[model samples]
Target: MSDTTATPTRPVNWTAISITAAVVMGGILAALLAVAPRDDGGIAWFDPMIPGGWMAWTLPVAIFFWCIASLLVTFTILAIRFPETPRVGVLRIETTRGDRLFISLLGSAFICLVWLFFAGLPVWGALALCLVYAAAVFRWV
Candidate 1:
């Protein structure tokens, strides 16, 4: 008898991947652009003729990137440590490495948005968010 352990087929979910990439990239870009604003102790108006103004824009992007990195590392660690767990929802999830990555990146964006809504936020916010995300992902996904 011939061995018949065929490779499992992957779902053709290009749309999901595309949307994920677009949202993540867009958020990062917006954040970077809003990173810095030059102020020389004077009232400065919007001037397209300025040079360093572009630097201010990089802040948001930097924060977004930082969030992503923080989430990725945090989730990876948790997923390995905890292994698989049942969630409060109607599904039991096995924490795969790929799932960990996806959840981390996506959840990081949401956490960053929430932080932004509550005035000036810090990198710690992102770190904390990653921790919560790791738990939630372990439970749910």
Candidate 2:
């Protein structure tokens, strides 16, 4: 008699995931734009002022640009290909891949907000601070 347990292993297909997400989001946005009402001034109620004029086309174009930016960030993280090195940090907490990503993204948002609050300060400083914050997060969350 033999007893065996198989471990499940599924590799992430980022390309497929990205494509599916884009298609789904595009469909939803298209439906929204199609059903969107017009304002008294004849502009789309759902459309706001951006670099381009407010129209059905602009929403999808803006969404596409945003998706591109998101994909770039995701690809950059995938390119790093960091191993799941869960380690106890200064706070005595074990950090994993999701934890690191969350910490890094949160730190970045915090850094950007601080930079915006202090409008006249040098942005280089904020970038440096963000780097230090990321290092510290990876070291000791």
Candidate 3:
């Protein structure tokens, strides 16, 4: 004799994945389109990425914030679809996905700041270092 009750299978959540992809792609597109004014330097008419009051925000700054927003959206989706248990990493502390993400972001910021201090702008090198630091944080903390 078989049991009357049975568990249902979990199908892949393509909709969640699609929405996450759209957020990331749209962010990238916005980053690419973030341009300062061709002629006028004033904030009243130019800057697509930044608002009127924020004259200090440039393409790099806009892209950085956009990337952070995209990451938050992706992580939210992941947490909802696949819940995870906190795991101990090299830091000797238990960390959930969100915790790990926070650590990574914090470390990457310091890394970029240090790189900027030592070197100079055109921050490609700093970005590369940040990427590696972020990967290592995710892998081993």
Return the TM-score for candidate 3, rounded to 2 decimals. 0.71
Q: For each candidate, what is the lDDT?
A: 0.59, 0.66, 0.76
Backbone-clash count (model 3): 0
lDDT rank order: 3, 2, 1
Find the 10 residues in a row with the least total lDDT in model 1.
Answer: 42-51
lDDT of 2 by residue, 15-133 (tens): 78667766766776666565544678564644653436456445545555555456455645554555566777776878775677677768777887888798645577877888788
Model 2 lDDT on a 0 to 1 scale: 0.66
User: lDDT of candidate 1?
Assistant: 0.59
Error of 1 at 141 (Å): 3.4
Q: Model 2: what TM-score? A: 0.42
Clash pairs for candidate 2 = none
Query: Could you tell which candidate, 1 or 2, scores higher by lDDT?
Result: 2
Clash number by candidate, in order = 12, 0, 0
- Best model per TM-score: 3
